[model samples]
Target: MVRIKRWLLAALVMSAGVSGFMLTKGTSHAATTDPQTFISTLKSPVTTVANQYKLYPSVMMAQAALESAWGTSTLTTTANNYFGIKGSYNGASVTMKTAEYDSNGQLYYTNANFRKYPSAKASMTDNAKLLRNGTSYNTSIYSGTWRENAATYADAANALTGTYATAPTYGSSLISIIKQYGLNTLLDASASDSSSSNSNSGSTPKPKPVVYSKATYYGASGTQTARLSGQYATYRLYNHVKGTRANITKTAWSKVAAGKNVLVYLDMRGVKKDASTGKKTTWYRIRFAKNTSAKKYWVYTKALTLPTVKYTSGTAAVKVNNTVSGSYYDHVFNSPYLAKSMGALNKLTAKSYVADKQAIKTQDGYKSTWYRIKVGKQAYWIAATETAAAPQYDAVTYSAASGTKKLSAKYSKYTLYNHVKKTHFNQKTYKWPAGSKKGTKVTVNFKGVKTAYKTTWYRIQFNGSQTNYWVDARALA
Candidate 1:
């Protein structure tokens, strides 16, 4: 009986040993064969998630490979938690041992709860949502402009270090995996497929034109207002039209000068075809801020390039009794360091009101001072050297006995005008300097009402100039 029992035991032992050996071989084979299969399985699901979330597929694939060990981790193989995402998914979860690092970067293992999904697709979708919305696990790391932050695989990979993983080399490891396997090709293929699908649908793809560095404004002409268009160019008050010359110009415009920006506003009223070129040319219009006579003018579309940069627009508080004195140019610039020349000022004058000031430090290390002033409603900057303070004088009454009454305090430091009319073109006439200094005395020869505007006027002889010109009475103090 004992011998029979020993034989049976030996047979049983041999059978058990054979079974164990087969199981080992099977596991080893799976270990060897599963990586490529796992990667292949991930491709479609990862791409789907990436496209839906505007994430880089290469980034998602690399992260999955690293986090799940090519789908071999117990968390991934059994629970389908590819990203080791730790949370409950519709009440499904698994408690597992995970390695983590504290603020000191020390690695340690701990038992924690992890999320479980029904399939790889669910896992990938959940992972994408986690990245898109972020979580308490690493709020600072993932909470940012999702689409812009994940626009590139490099950016997404770099964002994962320290925050997503404890290892400082986590980002580099994922990047290396992506590059080693040429996973970017998958992204290209996906994009090509998307393009093909779009084309097959007969949908036209129109890309927004990139704004280049330089643009010019073609001057406008006639009684028409110029139009400005485009997303950025919409700041200017003008009619917007799609796919027009103005829209194209605005889209491709960039700042050509330091502070000056320009835009070509198309005047639809003055569209004309050139007989010589056999091409249609549009008229462009520009208006000055303060001056009425020179308020609006038009130029041909061929004369100017569209403006690239958006100019700053607003009103500024004027300093009391402050004046700008300088050699004046008919053209006014938006900024002191001129890049954009808006239009001509009404009158060339030695002095005008000082609105604002800015001290600019140039790239070459030179400091420049710029003054802001209003022409009409538009504000502009000029060089500091062009401004001065008006002098104060006591009021004086006009008398025929003197035939040359001392200039009253009110008129002592006023903007001299050539003519006075009701219209702004005539009202804010050419700005001329009447006195050498603020209190400098001048001769008032005659006073009368302007026949055209029904406004009072004063005929005065300035101290320096022998020629006497008519100054408006309302212009006096």
Candidate 2:
């Protein structure tokens, strides 16, 4: 009877201790065998959380991998609890068996309560909060791991050893995993965070370039030209990351590519080269208007196709077509090349200016056309709205003009007009930055007004030039 009572008492004590860590089974979030996919899954959120909390993402990332065994651990797979954090999360908890050290420094396994997170982001957020805010007893306990506090990620890792986990080698384990997996490449080049190396501290983590996402979005120094192949859904980039799905229709650059030949204004976003194979991908941002104040979209330079511009021998002429058109840098290029435009040559010089060459192709719906020309030794491509001999404008059509206004702004465009059709031929070009008369209010002499369709078109000529331009009568006031 004594032995029986003693055995029962021992069982009761075990049950009470085990109660702290319930061993009930729970559902998993996601499971994957591919290490790359697993890393990709947590990288963005971890980096974001690190950036937000001012912690070394490298150390944090290493901890996650070491703790979750590359996201295969039951805590991670079942509860998305990558850090094995104790207690309930948002009132949700999971019971799981975990390894713990005993009073004699012996390792033992027992069930313990762990936080159950809704997603990897939630788990990451909770971990970041702990590292940043520390525990209830000590708020700055993990401050040594912060980018501001530690000079390098190793220091941060070392700081976490006994504090973050009971293991004395936790820091070295994190450092080893970080090196083995190459998680330090982009430590200084986080999606939107300022470079960590900017601080004088040697503790800033060196980079192994954790590719958090498949898309490699980067900033560029200049502009290029490209076209949208089709309607691409747009999103507002948060943290410099493509985030927050927005209603595409609400933006002005919305639904722009509707099987139309309308050209897009583009800026070269830059070319990204793969570090492994040296393969390159050129990218650009699209704008609907010439102004920089408008929103822009991203596009692959490869998709902005321009059929080989086959030039024929012999000079051609452009007659007044009374519609606006565009011209490109003889070829679409990645700079040391520019994608700017200028108002085409004046009507008088059209013939000789195009003397260099003339050729046409099956243009989709080019509005108006021009070819390579030269002024002195400098080569340029100019356009005029006369009759284009070889080019055809077949894809889209424009409606008759309406609501004529003589409105002008500080950055007035140097627009060209066709006398025959009394319509807009082309606008002032971006004349390669300086030496432009875009906003000069040339003195005008009014010819007369032709009222039709509830609007009036007024014919006028600038004081010094014989070219007659029709402005809406309302333009004078």
TM-score of each: 0.35, 0.35
Question: Per-residue error at 271 for model 2, in Å?
Answer: 58
Model 1, runs deviating above 4 Å: 1-34, 101-108, 136-151, 199-477
Instruction: State residue 464's C-alpha deviation in candidate 1, in Å.
Output: 71
Clashes of each: 28, 25
How well does candidate 2 match the true structure in TM-score terms? Answer: 0.35
Candidate 2: tens digits of C-alpha lDDT, residues 1-477 = 000100111111222122121222453233454555656666787788888787777777787776665665566666787777778887888886655567455867677677878787788788888888777865665666766656667777877754676455678888997787777765424722355456666354454432222334443323443344443322211122121121111222334542334466655454555433455655556666666665666554544543334444433333323233444343322232334544432332333332355434333545444455454466555443344222322222223432323334422333333331222223212221233243434344443333233444344444355655644434443
Error of 1 at 228 (Å): 52
User: Considering every candidate listed, which one attains the maximal lDDT?
Assistant: 2
What candidate 2 gets wrong by more than 4 Å, as runs, is 1-30, 106-108, 191-477
